[model samples]
Target chain A: MSFINYASREINLKIVYYGPGLCGKTTNLQYIYQRTAPEAKGKMISLATETERTLFFDFLPLSLGEIKGFKTRFHLYTVPGQVFYDASRKLILKGVDGVVFVADSQADRLDANVESLENLRDNLEEYGYQLEKLPYVIQYNKRDLPNVTPVEELSRLLNPGKVPEFSACAPKGEGVFDTLKAVAKLMLISLKKNEK
Target chain B: MLGSQSSLVLFDEEFSNITSILEKLLVEANAKALFLVDKDGQLISSTGETDQMDTTSLASLTAGNIAATGGLAKLLGEKEFSVLFHEGEKDNLHLSLVASRVILVVIFDQRSSLGLVRLRVRKWNEELEKIFNSLEKKAKEKGAGNQSFFAEITDEDIDNLFR
Candidate 1:
């Protein structure tokens, strides 16, 4: 859920990076946080368990220049990917504006991917949202892994609708911003705003 | 000037409209679930497809998190605790305070982006401020006694869960 504040002439948007455990959601944000220009980004906050898994969530506030006169600011969030944290997951998706799904490309984790998507749907329903219609993108991450699934196969299963998909090796910074740009474009399309 | 009785009507209307706006948001964000609960964590409205959402525990946890974080923020002299994000090894939780009247909770897949979630929260906050202001104004007009159009929640409703 994003607001175009006419008073301040600013458009604030919230985007959450979501996926299963160890699926590279946190890595993607870390990559972006490191690569982003200091003037355009904020501190990357990660609240995690002792094991370093995101305990609750992570946040990165960013500025994406201006469209017309409104400064389009984006807030980035990542949820703990562990399954038992289902309660925390529900708490995070309250008033979301856009989403980027980072699907793990490992063949054995296929079931995890599917189950995560199901959880996403169930949680969205709980919040009075429908999964099919949101401004979303899919990134088949960890493509560098030897046991990764074929991109085509992953695409068909994860993003059958063909809503923009990216092949990513997040740790190396491959396809990170490309995924972000695609989702941001999708978000702008939903608002009928010209992309800045 | 509109008197008090009419203000309550405005508040209810604003809340109703915000729910519709939220429905569009759930779709836009591709969220798995979303919730708008009051400070007490009572469910006011939800838009996405929640299959077995336990609003009871959802409200309780959300309020607890906000209170806890709010306390931490004040301790750190941050002035306000606007939002809290939890990224786990498997799933993630994003919680943002909705104009102090309510809390917005969202659950999403690892495929979603934090920036998008925060952007939407700002947008939701913009609209929510208006809704709360209208409702507050309506309450002022009506003498501020009982303004909630949603439910007849008691103090026990909030205290029972903690006990």
Candidate 2:
């Protein structure tokens, strides 16, 4: 849920990066952390296993400067994408304002991407939210890798809803900011439309 | 207001009441710090010795911790695990759910005991719940009457942030 602190003149929104395991959810966050200016970002916290897979979540707090005298603070989180981490994933979805589904753009991982997207929809339903109504976007990640699925195919499968989508090689930072900006803009627009 | 897209608005009067309660809890419990964070991990307000602390991370992690434990509660057929305590070599954490909407986090150490902290919290939780309940009710009653502060923002204002 978005938090509006009138006393502090701050607006806080939660956005979750979600997809199947190794789809570059954490990598997306790491890249954002690396590129963000020191004053604009807070410490990124990753609750990961010893092997570096996300165990619970990865959190990065960012200041998106000020909009109309209110400091717009966005807390970016990544859910553990492993199959058995479904419960943890559901927990992270609570009060989320937007979502980024980072799909691995490889031929073989198509099933994982589909399953994860289905899982995302189901989990969202449990929270009384429909993915269709939420501020959501998809990132076709790992576009630089050989054997990557065609962007058209990825879009045909994932973007049936036709939300803003991007193709990115997260480690190289391609489309990273573009993806972030798209979803953040969608969120602001949604807030405008929903607010009284 | 409990919907996913809904917002929790903290106006000045409610904010002052919350901060005063936090400050009172700080001295009454002799705690190092007190943080009133929404279940979503947004830090509503904090008091006491937090200058050296990374409260942003703390708030996020604490909410995550509570969430994980809450998941555990479901498996065992419970409503929720409303209270959690973590003991460290020096400082101990006392986290409890307040009004099911916010988390009350108490960071204490050798200067305080769990029994005392819990006692004070039990009393204050009632007061906190009243404030939050009224806040939620007010938000609902205000409904469409509340205007969007961002109504004046334009596309240029958004695009400029990226530039």
Candidate 3:
């Protein structure tokens, strides 16, 4: 959820990146953290297992810029994509303003993508949020891999609602900013719509 | 709009009110620092000894800790875990849930005792709850009306930020 603090002249928005295990949700956050200017980004925190799998979630805070006299800060989080971490994922989605479903584009992970998307919808529904109505986007990650599905096929399967979808290789930062900017733009537009 | 939207809109008046309460709590509790963080990990307000600290990271981690503990509680057939504490070599942390929407975190050292911090927190929790209740009502009314700041914000204003 977006928090507009008029006292501090700042607006805070929460955005969560979610996908199946090893779908590169954490990689997407690390790419953003590595590229963001030191002054613009806060320390990134990862609650992960000993083997580096996300045990809980990952957090990154980015200060974009000022908008209408209020500093705009985006708090980016990534839920643990492992299926057993359903409870943790639901906690992370409690107050989300936007979501980016980072689908692993590998042909073999199609079922994983579908299952994770369903889990995302169910978790959001528990919080009274409709995935169809929220400011959401999709990223087809691992696109540089050989076994990846075509963008068209991925879209046909994952982007049924036709939210802004991007092709990304998160580790190398390909299409990272584009995906971020698109969802951030949609969130800002949604804010304006909410005021109406 | 505020009634349905999960977003939190803090106007100047309520913000000051919350800040003052925090400041008072810090002095009364004799703590090193205190922070008010929402359940979603957003830092709402904080005071004392925070300049040298990374409050953003602290707030996010604190919320994560609370969520994890709350999950543990549900498995044990409890509704929620309202308080959490961490003792360290040099400092201690006292965390409590306020209004079921935000977390109140107090950090203290050898100079303060847990008894004092708990006493002050218990007394101020009610006042904080009242202010937040009023804040919700005010935000709902203003959001339903037309005085919203976003009302004056054109798409250009929003686009300009990214540029």
Compare the candidates by DockQ and give the number of the best one: 2
TM-score of 3: 0.97
- Candidate 1 lDDT over A1-196, as tens digits, reads 5544333455566687889999999999999999988988866777788888998787777777766555666767787788998877766665566888889999999989988988888987776777777778889999999998999998888887788889999999999998988787666555543211
lDDT of 3 by residue, B97-142 (tens): 9888789999999999999999999999999999888887887788
Query: Where does model 1 exceed 4 Å of error?
Result: A193-196, B1-64, B67-131, B135-163
Which CAPRI level is candidate 3?
A: medium
TM-score list, all predictions: 0.59, 0.98, 0.97
DockQ comparison, 1 vs 2, better candidate:
2
Best-fitting candidate, scored by TM-score = 2
RMSD in angstroms, candidate 3?
A: 1.8
Which segments of model 3 are wrong by more than 4 Å? B1-4, B144-148
Sequence-dependent TM-score of model 1 = 0.59
Compared with the true structure, what per-residue lDDT tens digits does model 3 show for residues A4-42? 887889889899999999999999999999999999999
Q: lDDT values of the candidates? A: 0.71, 0.92, 0.90
Q: Please give the lDDT score for candidate 1.
A: 0.71
**TM-score per candidate for chain A alone:** 0.96, 0.99, 0.99
Q: Write the per-residue lDDT of candidate 2 for residues A107-186, one digit (tens) a residue.
A: 99999999999999999989899999999999999999999999999999988999989999999999999999999988
